[model samples]
Target: MGSILIKDTTREERERIVRESLGDGFDVTCGYDDAGIDYQQYIDGKKELRELNAEADCGFVVAHPEEQQKGCNNI
Candidate 1:
């Protein structure tokens, strides 16, 4: 119910915001980590959510493949 801007929130708030927004959506595929988004920057107040989201939408993010999981389809 308040501003989530880096300057408007604390580190803990930023952590919660990022986690809640990305909850259950983090995986080897299509994940912020795999997409090379430094979400930690947001938590550190060095970057904003919009910055990260923009990177994800620009279609130019580098992909880092994760190791294959045995018997795991992420289901």
Candidate 2:
């Protein structure tokens, strides 16, 4: 609801935002899940959530003829 910009939020707020967005994938006691680890940049204020989400969206499998799996299947 409020601003999620790095300058606008405290480190704690950023952590809470990422954790809540991830739902059960995150553990308050154990920390980030494998999928959740990508948000570390957001938590550290090195990047915004939008930037991270954009990177995720842009993900694609590169062609690797050497591997049995090719293209999107590589993902």
Candidate 3:
């Protein structure tokens, strides 16, 4: 597994980078920080939004930079 730090970046860019890095046979798991918002509420809101657009698996979280650093270390 590999990870990269993205500052002031868009979701599309992140997704593209992940896809390219993992190649065609890998499953991607995306983690983010919630920025201190209510997790369930945000998830519900995202579900509703996705329902409106026929999308799926939409939500976010505020990730600790330290934790991300640890993840990178593990990699």
Prediction RMSDs, each to the true structure: 12.5, 7.5, 13.6
Candidate 1 lDDT, 1-75, residue by residue in tens: 899899899998988877787785553233375557778888888878777766654455335446645653232
Off by over 4 Å in 1: 24-31, 57-75
* Candidate 2: segments with Cα more than 4 A from true spot: 24-37, 57-75
Model 1 lDDT, residue 53, Cα: 68
Better of 1 and 3 by lDDT: 1
Ranking under lDDT, best-scoring first?
Answer: 2, 1, 3
lDDT of 2 by residue, 31-66 (tens): 344434367788888988776665563434547757
Candidate 3 lDDT tens digits, 1-75: 333333433455555654564475543443222222222222322322213223223364447755554443221
Model 1's alpha-carbon lDDT is 0.70
Q: In model 3, which range of ten residues has the least summed lDDT?
A: 33-42
As a TM-score, model 2 comes out at: 0.60
